[model samples]
Target: MSGHKRFWKAVSVAQENGLFEPRLDGRPIRLPQGKVLAVRSSALAEAIAGEWGQIAEGASFTPDSLPLTRMAGTMIERIAPDPQTTRDMLLGFGVDDGLCYCADGINPVAEQVFAWLSGYGIHPSVTDGLMPVVQPEGYLEAVGQLLATQGDLDLAVLGVLAQATGSLLLSLAVVGGAVSLVDAVLWANNDEKSQLATWGQDDELVRTMENREKDILDAGMFLTLGRQVSI
Candidate 1:
């Protein structure tokens, strides 16, 4: 099965068996499923490295051996590690590239994220027309909490969504997989196109997009009229 389908299946099974009831809400939230996908994805990536490096890790394992349960162990290890690299890896490019999307999309939430980063001297700017709306008494602490949760969610969603929908990042992975001369050049150009493509469609992409919206909501970032201010 495709990674996204497999991930949802695993989550559905685990939920049915009550394995995820403890850490998740009773309403069947996607967080547990997301976590499972994250660990499985990382383990798969590591296994790929082992394959290329000739290390023989999990040489006999089947496709069912999704090792996503271990991702929680690496959470603390990644926190505050390398912001630039993490942003690039998650967004399929650098912070600047993400900002470009924010501007193009006129995504208020992403603008707020950039604004928050800029407050810490990151100074992420918008080239097209994207700009953060200003607000007063902004809950920086609440924003931090939301960002922490989002950090975890993005790791899971990015890989699965990209794989499901042939996103730019997945194109990069495909290029890495080609492992040949002429294929690399063609793959590079394809990756460029994928990166610059519009993103209004793709159901899987909406999962991550919805998660971002929820993060903003959970962070109490909305103003009195239930609208996001340009804070």
Candidate 2:
């Protein structure tokens, strides 16, 4: 007998209007806004259902336990409804992109970031950590346009990545396959790692970094699964 007392005995996917819906005990799951949760990718729907199915009935759990579900809900309830707001929020990160800020006048990862952005015709200005770097108007416009091209799901995933890493460039790099998720995490935590080297390692800080890495990886998986075509 399974100790996991799940609320739903079975999980299934329903196809409607070319979108997939995950059902709990034959009832469609609804988002926070009361809309039935549906996604363009059947794979994503299944993954979301898997999260729900894994929940133990009468067992404690939080939103953090359901990353895929939370992301899918975000796509439906937030990003899909007002894409411009989300796009602008993501673009805002570029204005003071973490990669552009160099402490001690040196950022080892800046050259790689520059090369990645070059593919999209964006050349951002870099500056020492002392002052904020104002990105060019053209660069902002280009980044906005690039973000606009992303679908709701991609935007949602990018939002997670940007929030986790605090750098739109690193998020975009992950999306564009310009860098591995490992590299992105490493680059994003470069300053912190440098500090850890100077100061003794703090267990709490290390734990926080590990959680952040997991979030980034989860976002990457969500993006990949969401892009898959249902057979």
Query: Compared with the true structure, what per-residue lDDT tens digits does model 1 show for residues 131-219?
Result: 53332243333333333434433443333333333332222222222222222223223324454465435666455544433332221
Candidate 2 wrong stretches, greater than 4 Å? 1-6, 104-109
Alpha-carbon local distance difference test for all models = 0.32, 0.83
Q: Kindly give the stretch of ten consecutive residues in candidate 2 with the minimal lDDT sum.
A: 1-10
In model 1, where is the ten-residue run with the lowest total lDDT?
220-229
Candidate 2 on 1-231: residue-level lDDT in tens?
124345667788999999999998888987767999888888888898888888776665667888998888898999988999999989889888887777666454556767878888999887775688888779988888889788888899999999899989878878887778888788767767877999988888888788889889899989999999857
Displacement of the residue 72 alpha carbon in candidate 2, Å: 0.8
Candidate with best lDDT: 2
Alpha-carbon deviation at 198 in model 2, angstroms = 2.2
Name the TM-score of candidate 1. Answer: 0.26
In candidate 2, how many clashes are counted? Answer: 1
In order of appearance, the predictions have TM-scores of 0.26, 0.90
Instruction: Look at candidate 2 and give me any clashing residue pairs.
Output: 5-57
